[model samples]
Target: MDRSAEFGRWKAQSLSKADLSRKGSVDEDAVEVVELLNSREEFFTTSSCAGRILLLDGSTEGSGVQKQHCCWLLVTHKPCARDDVMAALKGATSEAVLKFEPFILHVQCRTLQDAQTLHSVAIDSGFRNSGITVGKRGKTMLAVRSTHGLEVPLTHKGKLMVTEEYIEFLLTIANQKMEENKRRIGRFYNYLQHALKRETISNSHSKIKERNNPLCTHKNRRSQGKAQGPSTTEDNGRELEDGDGLEISAALFLGDD
Candidate 1:
C-alpha cells in the first residue's frame, strides 16, 4: 500500500484499540502534548507518562524489587507529600520502594525524518536521552526521556529502614525532580507548537496547492516560487509539505529554557 493509505490504516487501528494502561487515560501532565501530537498527520503519541512519585509493595529478593510484580501502594503524578509516602509505607508487607520517575513518551512518526525532527526537539527541551528507532517493518518511533529518576528502598521485610528525617529528605528531592519534569514538559510543548505545528500545517492541502502552483502570487513584496520551499517532505510515492518548514528544520533543532 501507499504511505498515506498505510499510515491512515495503521493510525486507525492503533487509535481504535483500548487503553491498557493502569490509569486508562493520559496522565494530566502529558495531556496537552498528547493532544497536540494526535492533531498532526505526522505524529501520534503511542504511550506517555507525565512522571510520577510512587510507593510500591513487593518481594525483597536479592535486595531488589521488580516493578512488574509489585503492588502500587501510592502513586502521584504531582509532587508528592511526606505524609502520603509515610502512610503508604505502613501497608508494605515485604519490600517497599519509593520512586520518582521522570516524564517519558513514545511517539510514532509517519517517517524517519519526523522521528528525527521530534528527537531534536526532545533533546533541546532537556530530554537529552531522547532517540529514534526504525522498526524492521519500517515503523519510525521516537522516545522522549531523561536520566533524572530516583529509586530508594524504604522497607525490607515490612520494616521501615530509614528514619523519618531521611524520608523527609527524599521527599524534597523527589518533589524537586517532579517540578523539573513539569518544566521540561512545558518546554517541549512550546517547542512543538513552534516547530511541529508548522510542519503539520504544511502537510495539509496547502502542500498540493504549493506543488501545483509554486510561483503564482506576489506577497511580502516579491515572492512566488518561494512558496515551493515551504514544506518538509515526509513520505515517498506517498504524501505530505515545504520551504519555511524546511528552513525551520534546517535552522533549528531549537526551543525553550
Candidate 2:
C-alpha cells in the first residue's frame, strides 16, 4: 500500500484502544520510546538528565521522572533575526534551539522538567510562549495541563506525553507565523515600490526644473534686450540738451554702448 494508506492504517491500529495497558509493569516499548524522545541533543541529552533530575528532586522526591516528548510553540512579538535566535539558543544550557530559520525555531526535550526549562529559556530570550499540548498512544504516568481548551489526546499514561503534542503545536504556530511574515514582507515591498515611485517622480520634477530654469532665464534676457535697446539709444540722443553734464554723459554713454 502507499505510504499514506500505510500511515492511515497504522494510525487506525494505534487508536484501537485509547490506552494500551502493559501486562503489569512499564512496557519495554514505552521505555524505548521515552529514551528515543529524550536522546536528541535538542531535548534533554543524557548529560542534562542529571541536572534536570536534581531540579525535579528539589521540587519533590516523589515528583517522579515522567518522560515527555513535547514541542514548544513560541512567537516573537517583533521580527527576530535568525542569528539572534541561534545565539540565544547557543547561550542557553537547558534547551537547545534545534532549527533557526528566519524567525522560527524547533526544539525537543525528554521530560516536562526539561520542557519547562527550555520554555523558560525561550521566554528569557524574548520569545512569547504561545501554547503547548501533549499526546500519547499508550499508558504512562505523564500528566498534561489541558485546561486551555485545546483538544488533547489522553492515554492510559497519566497525561498524554506532551512533548510530541507540543512539537506538533509549535509547527502549526510556526507555519502560521511564517504566513504572517510573508504577508508583512509583501506589504513592505509594496511600500518600497510606492516610495521609489515617489522619489522618481520628485527627481523627474527636479530635472525638469533644472532643465527649464536656464531656458526661462535666457528668454527673460532676450526679452529685456529687445525692450530696452532702442529706447536707451533714443534717450541718449535727446540727453544733450543739459550742458557740461551732457558732455560727460555723452562720452560715457557712447563708450558704454
**Tens digit of lDDT per residue, candidate 2, span 1-257?**
75345434543453344443223222222233234334333231111100000001011123448733333323232334434433333233232333322222233333343344333332322234222234363111122111111122222222223354464554455445544434432332243233334334544555565576755453454333233222221234444554212111010011100
Per-residue lDDT of candidate 1, residues 167-199 (tens digit): 999999999999999999999898878766555
TM-score of each: 0.78, 0.25
| TM-score of candidate 1 on Cα atoms, chains taken together | 0.78
Q: For this target, which candidate reaches the highest lDDT against the unseen true structure?
A: 1
Off by over 4 Å in 2: 1-94, 98-162, 214-257
| TM-score of model number 2 | 0.25
Worst 10 residues of 1 by lDDT: 242-251
Clash count list over all predictions: 10, 11
